[model samples]
Target: MMSALVLYVTDDCSLCDQALELMAAAGAPDFQSVFIDDVPALQTTYGWRVPVVHDGHRGRELDWPFDVAALRAFLQPG
Candidate 1:
């Protein structure tokens, strides 16, 4: 089964765009995207770290600068 994952992102973010590309290359499972632009708390937490992959099932977060392999590992179920 696929794990629950959330991709925290923002508008006009190049890195976030790259993250989507990497996820596709890594064959990522179904996930939800949450924009941080309008949420103050989200902005505070992920302002500098857009394109973050949050593993809701494991309560883990994978920050940017991750490659396809890393994304694959993050998408793996426990």
Candidate 2:
């Protein structure tokens, strides 16, 4: 299975929660969801860009709102 990382960058963002839920439903066994508000550097870099999903292994990122297919592709190995 491929490893995936998701950065849900948002402070009190509903969209971020939605993204997490989506990932859970998509068979993402293990994924990291980092909130932008929690990290200073992430806040500075992606202040308003919430619900961003990052594939650490692949070094790829996908910002929401993303469809199921797009998300699956991002999570999978190329």
Candidate 3:
């Protein structure tokens, strides 16, 4: 099994919903959704950039506005 990707998101964020949809469409690997609103550090780091997809092991990130193709590329091993 592939490692789980971390999806940083906030409540009431339409973009986050869209990002989830895109990830599903792209057949992305397992992932965990992290709500950043409660964590000060996470809020500061990803407040303006919600819907961020991160590969923990690889330390890579894919921000919003990504399509299926870009998502596929981002999920690739470095």
TM-score, each model? 0.91, 0.80, 0.91
Write one digit per residue (lDDT tens) for candidate 1, span 3-77: 488889999988998998888899988888889999999999999988899988889999998999999887777
Q: lDDT per residue, candidate 2, 1-78, as tens digits? A: 444576666767888878777887777657766767778888776777778887777777788788667777777777
**In terms of lDDT, which candidate is strongest?**
3
State the local distance difference test value for candidate 3. 0.90
Q: By TM-score, is 2 or 3 better?
A: 3
Weakest 10 consecutive residues, lDDT, candidate 2?
Answer: 1-10
Q: TM-score for model 2?
A: 0.80
Clashing pairs in 2: none
Ranking by lDDT: 3, 1, 2
Q: What is the C-alpha lDDT of each candidate?
A: 0.89, 0.74, 0.90
Cα displacement (angstroms), candidate 3, residue 57, comes to: 1.0
Q: Tens digit of lDDT per residue, candidate 3, span 35-71?
A: 9999999999999988899988888888887889999
Cα RMSD, each candidate: 2.3, 2.8, 2.0
